[model samples]
Target chain A: MQPTETFFSGFAPHDLWFLGEAALRTLWLSLLAISIGSMIGVVFGWLLSVSRIGGGFVLSPLLDIFRSVPLIIQLVLFYNFAPIIGLRLDAFDAGLIVLIVYTSANVAYVARGGIEAVSQPMRRAARSLGMTYWQDMRYVVWPIGLRAVFPAWVGVALGVMKDSALVSVLGYVELLKASQILITRTQETILILAIAGAFYFALSYPISLYAAHLEDRWNQ
Target chain B: MDYNFHWRPVFKALPDLLQAALLTLEVAAISMILGVLIGLGLSLIRIHMKGPVMWLASIWVELARNTPALLQLFFFGFGLGAFGIHFSPYLIVLMGLTFNNAGYLAENFRGGFGAVPDTQIRAARSLGMTAFQTYTRIVIPQVLRIVYYPMTNQMVWAVLMSSLGMLVGFRELSGETQFFASRTFRIFEYFAVTAVIYYIIVKIILGASRLLAMRLFRY
Candidate 1:
């Protein structure tokens, strides 16, 4: 079908809704990945921070190299290569796992930084009050560290949201992939792609502003 | 685990992969050069321009920063064709990286500019420096020093992100790797080699940047 001269002519109501559904998938995948990623990251990051002084000194450079490779490369590597190594995963599962690792890597760094940002005196003060180690973390170190890393975490969220789009390479029906299907079907490539970009811009713009606000308040 | 490790396919593919690696670096270097020049202009406009012009520049920066680079590439490669403008994959990917890089570098540059106190610019102006003279002789030199590290990071980032060109059929390093992997049916071996190639590329870039930074910024 030849597209009309105008960019907007071909999108039916359901076509718009199709784009909406794709956006929902993007949000779902991003939210799911970030939630799981954060949980795993806390453990890894806590260990990294705790052991940085003497032990577990080895994991830092490993994580750095792991993350340095492009997300696309990692996604393709994990998705295509895992099954042959006795780790079988379908496209969606593969995408999810790799993205979790991707997001978790960033979160791990943030978590480590957050942990280190907690003051030594504060830890001692909590311990002097007869609080256990867990209590000290729950009360003092956790709150301060979490607060210090809030802005950085938001930045990671934005990064994860964008990175999730790369999972489309594995044939996941996320926003970018869905937009490709629609563009082909309707011959409205420009409109569909613009819509997809707008969806992402919508998600990220407000969060960025909020992150900026948090940074400003923190600086104050 | 029943997998057999085969290094032969990877070794056989080395020459093509290395050549493709060179292509990847070329694209990244060109995009970064373009990004820096355009980013400098964008930063200037964002900071100095007013009204709709400023708003437009800001929206460009924000959208590029926020969207996935993959989608951004598709927008150019496929989306422009709907408007009767078709670009080759190489051009599309280049535009994508350049646009995204410009947005990020613009913000970095803006921050660098903010770090320089107004007193310095005023001092230059009072010393008979024109606006252009003040910027060329004083402001930009200092801002360049402050922003050099971030610029290196962005350069490395461009190299990595250009891997997305594979999706658009641009035969950069990853694209070539994908091609070889599919043909050989040796997915693991092929990607593992590509991963190592990528690692080496990244290390070389980081090392080179550090050495360059040391030479350029001695106290």
Candidate 2:
């Protein structure tokens, strides 16, 4: 690529395409992190519910480290530390690893709360009805507990989506990073930022509205 | 993995990093104070006002909550520069954090206000207290008690969110860590210690909050 001569240019039509692609990267990263993280988190949460001694002593504090630190710091630490440990990971891979751990740490707490929200007597009733342990969980606990925790899970998912913007610090060209590029090149900081902010608002607002709607319906 | 670990530079930089950590807490504390004031006004306006003013508060709350904090910091930095209104990196971070905190806290305040039943306000007014007096003497105390825990959480959030200042070139704890880490190329060693410092700061805030809660809530 040749160095361009111009210091500032007008916003051309193609910047929209760049923003779109970057938004997709943000979405894709968040989706991958939330799905994998939630699965691991659910299992961790189950272990917590089933075995108090092991989970409380060992697993809880381990997860707390991820929650307590800022996501930006965690990204920088992992991105830099990976090479030292012989893992030749790229920016995207390293960020995904960190985000997945971060997501699971958050979701594990929410999932544990959801499981415990289902009263012990309700589970006991299911077991007394000749339901196996797995059967009791799959049938009674899953549906009831999910309703109680779905809104909280949605909050975590949205939070992860917004936080995926931090991956840009690692040089993965996500939406926020793309805006920075456009702003520097075009000298149209406000316009490009407004466009980028709109993309985030568009992506986030509707799901939150839907979550609120679901919460209202469930309460009724 | 033949990377040589270096703790010497990190140990030497501990004092600078600790000072930066104090700056982090300072800005966060200032922002929290400003945010709570703005947030309280916003909640009251949303509940009591009408037309364009209410819309303005609603817009602020929605924009702040729906977007990323880093983006919001960028908005205060480069976005305002478009209008020829440039802010120093410190101002940019302070504005961004205050904006974000007020949005979230407004929602919490609104919820707290709702939890205080209308009947008490009516009762206070029926006793010939003025509207302002009713709120100040009766309503606000209850609202404050209800929202105290959420306020503590928001304070911790302010500290965490202020770390974004590094991106905007504010030399807070994370920025200082990044500065030293880059200079020495001891990225892992520098950041590992920085992470522990962040953990300690968060723990202190949580511990202090617990003690305050006990003192305030005791019957």
Candidate 3:
């Protein structure tokens, strides 16, 4: 933490150990958000595919607003205003709520769009096969829609991973905030930020590659 | 504990918040324009560059798309100062956003270019159009049309991403809200009003883009 300290020379073994823990924390939070959010998205998306006014008119617009607003501002609001709303959430829970809501909005849109894109003629064919609405959805729409939605879900998962850094602003001590802590202690921004960026890239890139793999497989 | 609703603090901070919203718009607008140009250039490089050069372009896209924007902001804001080079918060954020926008838009523009039929380019070339003239007259216009929706999406993204400037202590709309909310202890009201402003700004952009789409794509 000296004035003339080098970012590399100032680095200790435990600075990395701290980063490891933060990476794990970031991973768990993003996984939780994506898993739960995608589940909620499937239900809402299915509903949207079926209903016009409620899904098209209301839910779609609501989700657009959610996507348009920045995640950090939403974090700040939910964290600070929890008390006013009679909600007693710790920082982790508050962060999770924001992550889930944000992820779900994006996923829901993807899911709905995917369902709608599953060709009208195929649905008519399914109907001619004596399939009930539920049976048709279970057999046809869900499979086709899910295939189209997977690539987008990958994007949402990566987006949630990056935006998870914002939860640090709410004092969650996640990866980015932990790096901020390290910067204060070591007085080296370059090394710390670079490591943080690399960690995020490591976390996100594999998921993307996997999505690409699945997309190719499905396309074939 | 029961909470009493207050609108006074929100009303008093209105002018500053509006000004800050404009600043946010300015940052987004400038970065988006710069981003589109850089993105176009980068896409050209991605398509035309060979071997290591193309790999380098792809790396930029991957890095920018994958990492957190906040990290890029911090790197520009604080990391460069480690080398005794300081950037103003505005400049740092602009740099960060430009980097990010170029990366995402490069990929987008590449796809746009792909969507343009090869036959058109060949047809233009056969008619004695120079390379530059072919691009300007035939290819780029179609690429712009193909990518227009993605461009608007990027605009909304830039506007939202500009809020990160607050973390570097740059006072855009969210930053101003953070400032006043803490001072007035009106976190809810300030953010609520600010949220409405963000919502309105996004709505306007969406509305305007819709109108433009209808008019321009009326084929």
Specify the highest-DockQ model's number. 2
Count steric clashes of candidate 3: 0
Relative to the true structure, candidate 1 reaches a TM of 0.93
Clashing pairs in 2: none
Location of the lowest summed lDDT over 10 successive residues in candidate 3 chain B: B181-190
Per-prediction TM-score: 0.93, 0.97, 0.95
| Model 2 per-residue lDDT tens digits across residues A1-220 | 9978887888999989998999999999999999999999999888787877789988998888887789999999999899888898998999999999999999998899889999999999999999999999999999999999999899899889999999999999999999899888889888899999999999888998899899989989
Which tens-of-lDDT digit does each residue in B1-219 have in candidate 1? 777878898898899999999989999999999999888888999889899988988988998898888888888888787778988888998999999999999999999999999999999999999999999989998999999989988988898999999889999999999899889888778887888888899899999988988888887
Candidate 2's displacement at residue A92, Å, is 0.7
The true-versus-predicted C-alpha distance at residue A78 of model 2, in Å, is 0.5
Off by over 4 Å in 3: A1-9
Which stretches of candidate 1 lie above 4 Å from their native place?
A1-10, A53-56, A121-131
* Model 3 agreement with the true structure over A27-124: per-residue lDDT tens digits: 99989998999889778887677889998898888877778788888888888788877889988999999999998888888888888879999999
Chain A only: list TM-scores of all candidates. 0.90, 0.96, 0.90
Model 2, position B194, has a per-residue lDDT of 89
| Reference-based lDDT, residue A13, model 2 | 95
Q: List the residue pairs that clash in candidate 1.
A: none
